[model samples]
Target: MEEKFDLLPLLEYIPPSSLDYLEWVSVGMALKHEGYDFHDWDVWSQADSRYNAHEMESKWASLGHNGGQPVTGAFITMKAKENGWLSRQYEGDGMETFGWDDEISYERDYRFVDKAWVEGKEIQEPGDNWNPVEQLQTYIQTLFSNDDHIGYVVDSWQREDGKYSVRGSGVYTKTAEEILNDLEKYKDQKDLGWAVGDSKKEAGAWIRFNPLDGKGVKNENVTDFKFALVESDNMSLEKQNAIMRELELPIAALVYSGGKSVHAIVKVEAANYAEYQKRVEYLYKICNKNGLQVDSQNKNPSRLSRMPGVIRGEHKQFLIDTNIGKSSWEEWHEWIEDLNDDLPEFESLAGMFEEDPQLAPVLIDNVLRRGHKMLIAGPSKAGKSFALMEMSISIAEGLPWFGFNCERGKVLYINMELDRPSAYKRFKDIYQGMGIKPANIQNIHVWNMRGHSIPMDKLTPKLIRRAQKEKFDAVIIDPIYKVLTGSENDAEQMAKFTNNFDKVAAELGTSVIYCHHHSKGAQGGKSSMDRSSGSGVFARDPDAILDLIELEVTDSLRDMQGKRATANFYAEKIRDENPSYLNEIGQDDFLSAAEMRKHLAAALGDDRAWQISGFELGEVQKRVKLQTAWRLEGTLREFPKFEPVNLWFNYPLHVHDEVGVLKDLDYVGTDKPYNQRKAAVKSRDSAEKKAERKKKTTDELISAFSILDEGDGVVRIGKLESYFEKSRNTIKNWLKNQDVLMIDEEGFVSMRLELD
Candidate 1:
């Protein structure tokens, strides 16, 4: 009554009612009691109709049977479209296939060769032996016959083997000569290559590639990946051959890759390695953009026929029960059950998350602003030390961090392990990227003195005192091991260092961030502070704690060169006990409108002004606050964005307080006039130190007259002086007796223009 399929392989096509992506487990369990193994069981399913049981029920109803008898199952899916084939197709075989298709289902197994292959192997798979040779014939005839494009890009992902390997995805295209010749066009000038790669394949999709021609050595980390057949369900018009797309031909080519990680090779011979790497990463982007996901974890040992959690937990019992079902092996059932009980649970940690989630909460989850203390810990090479160095430099310079705002403050990084030059070189890369000038790089200071032999107790307070005097706002003690020598387990010793560190910070008002390492065997449920190798010392000593967990990733770049790897931050404690800052839960010092305006005006290099007028504090606040400008607490004489607000705090013109920045700033007198206030100093009327020139005029006139009356014709200009000394110019002018007209220029008081 139904239209029979006409193609030869149509009969070989497994019914959809039998096998499904989610039906394998129940089918596995159904075959559990019989055969040497579940793989011996068989069913047939069409790829499209495997998971619909409702249609099978209707079919059985038409047969005048109740629900007892199983019917071929199927699924009917349709989107909002004018499809001409307004019909449902059914396909399935065997009890599992003929049964209902719900979220839970056992697979439909069919086809003689497929059954044979499943029987031969411990596990059954749809792609195991689906007529590979026959499918190959179909593929070449249907898809490749008339194709003009000689190559195809293949992307493969495997859950095992902890390596993110890559290779030429463009399958065997032109001859090696042609490929090399094309890339050689850039030979006139050495330029970086392009980028390719799907985002799923690597962290960032850009890579480097040169000619595979007789130049670089062969890439050793090369391999082929086998994937399940669902990868090609969605194909673009550009991807499919015209012949393949037109005929509605079954194009069932598998997902395979012949790729190698050319990272090292690319690095070696690259004209510009960074550019080339970016180019290779571009390839992966195209692959994924083409609607492809090759996430196929290996399914070895087959899925547990029962609940996975149960089967693994009671593997021994399942084995014993399996053996008991064998008619001849029934007598050894007790022995098998006991043997099964002793069997260890099969665990494959190949693709499991390497870092602990519990600890992630303790790591830096949000942002880390300047003036924050954190105790970072992990094993050696776990990046504890390197991270401290990087963080110190970054915070000090106010460099961009993971796209958040950076605040610059003087970071006194004291490290015993690394040399100063080595650490400074690392800072160069980050500093340059931010477009910050070197002279403004004063925020980052790597102390040269190594603390190799200094015991924690012997570490003098003078070290931090000098740094405080130098105006460093932050201190970093890299690796707590450097200063600590005695019992790390002793809470008393740890408390001492913690107390001292806290004391120094309080006295100096500097944030002190410490670093330590994690103990071995720390895994799930380990708290960050818990991982510190010594006896809870790190926990007691710092205000914040960030854990470092290195999860094994399959990224080639991360595997080799990325030392200071993926990191996180956490704020465990906020020891805001500094009395100076206490009860003062307020924002950091920010410039008022007038202050910012004045600073910006001064910095823009305009000179010769009256009282620095026209700069409104409220108006300047409106723009910077509305626009969200950079920090400039320091270095504001240049209108710097680095620590923008800091320039206002310590600037001589402004004093910061809770009520908002008090702006009646006085000049911080210097032997030399303030360079920034040159115009103000220049415009100032000299010899005006006296209060009310009128009040002092008469006294000075009387004094001058008295002096003149007692003098020999005239008084020396240098002789008459106030309790406050007068300059020679002041004395000459005063003694000249301009008001009373009594004194002369050379300090000779001669009667000149006398008062009436």
Candidate 2:
């Protein structure tokens, strides 16, 4: 089918019965024109053998594709694992993919010509003076005599698999001469020859191919050469040579990381097995530096490959956006097309993420990372500040407060409304329950009021400088309105600040969490872009956006019966999640049951945190956020093995999986909030009751504290216990007399004392 000198045709010229199997040389050269798959060797002896359709077409397609200087008496075989190519590798021998050292080594030429021959299906060509392998052997043998580093096989023997087993030791042993004598010994007995040379080295070729082109006469049975791989826009001579130089094999394409140019592909001529291993290691390194996971890569034929490409400096001829970062395969394809139209100056986007060590967690692992430009726009009384105050504390501490773990990071509360100390006190109460000192919360930086604000992006970096200069890992912005520089929805204005924000956060390698309120009438805890009060720019460039909604939050189970249950919904906006518009039934407002085509667009793009709250379906959404919303109920004690993501994702107020949801308590109506506690084991026996009593006393001593107003007559332990309806022993265990108890001159119970 093809006009080229296809080995398939040559195959027909030989009788299969004469040879048990086909050898490597023919397969190697034929693959150059034919597809790599070539023929099914198992079916080679079939009488009805017909060529593969694709291979037939490709061979004909490349009428003029042939390049490289031909070898005269050439022979091809697998680099016989035993005594062959690998064992020949040595250090300083430098088994690089591609290398162009000066001059042709003449002694290397004769050895290859002296042994080995070409064997096809049934055709076998004995010794020829121009054998490339013999030349290679001669070059190697001569090198051993001249250079201490170059070595030849110390010993080799033929294995039944048609290969030579070789053994060599030490680091860089030069054995060019040993190889030549060994070839001589086999010369008469086997009628096979072996040698090596680089048609790639121009000066070497000058002494070998053509003197006019700086090549000399060829003595080996070498035929036209083959390039290992090719990867370039063009197949010009210069390009081919560049490929040969970078990679020892003349590969056509260089699918490196940047994919910008071919200067990346390289070649290594392994002098020994050790050098060969080093080459493979180098290939893996290139992949790693390019952000490619070796385990994730699934290329079978890939002996090695370079990164996409390197960014030399400011490249205009070929352009990339520095800000755009690494593009996916499809994304890169689209970007390149766009470049053709506009010719934007390309910036090196690779290695940008590596600039920050802290950000490495998000980049290296497939875990999610987000940036937020939240707009808390709800009406004043909608508990906007309350929601923010709560969420901000959560991010500052790795543990969740109510029922959610927000990709916890540093927090900066920029609250213009609340008094600083009041904010501190509220945080203090939460911290008291948390059992950690609030003073040691380094990541939580509060910019107490509006005037202290700078651009949102500057928040993370400046705080990071403060944290590291001071020691913190995260930054938080509270009540988003205080720190915003411009109108919320203005794209230009919002973009300027958020871009700066993301840039600085990325640069400093810190995760910034912002707390903002939802707009009035916004449906849920999370509001879409349309509902976000400002420019709605937050929806565009975030790693993740989390929306928190609270229905009427009741402190007690009795209070939740008639109110809209607090509802929280978080949508992962990055990647391709279908429009939240429709569910299984293709309906948008499953409740309003509206057939809207789309869910509300987000306030920010990418995956960033967005808080949305307010819903009557606290019961339904809790199931949904668990099965649907944040998705898990119960407590850490319940799913002890689950990850942080599973525990407390939907923090509906009072839905403390740590304790239980608000519905479990009577904080608002049922009795007193103090009565709420984990279900305790019941003990009916006297001993168990006594143990329980002791435990209760211990609890009182550890946790209970009394409060009083203008109390001078604090009372003695017995009286204090009697007034509170607690046992005297329980009161005494808790140090009741120190605050509530009073001692008189006669050491009698006194009622006057102060609560310390």
Count clashes in each candidate, considering only residues at least 3 apart in sequence or on different chains. 75, 179
lDDT, candidates in the order shown: 0.36, 0.36
Supply the TM-score for candidate 2: 0.27
**Model 2 misplaced regions, further than 4 Å:** 1-397, 401-412, 433-443, 450-468, 520-530, 552-654, 657-756
| Candidate 1 structure quality by residue, lDDT tens digits, 347-426 | 55764466443321111223332334567665655444545655665566565432334466677777777777766665
Residue 714 of model 2 has an lDDT of 39
Evaluated against the true structure, the overall lDDT of model 1 is: 0.36
Error of 1 at 94 (Å): 92
TM-score of each: 0.25, 0.27
Instruction: Point out where model 1 deviates above 4 Å.
Output: 1-372, 402-404, 429-439, 555-756
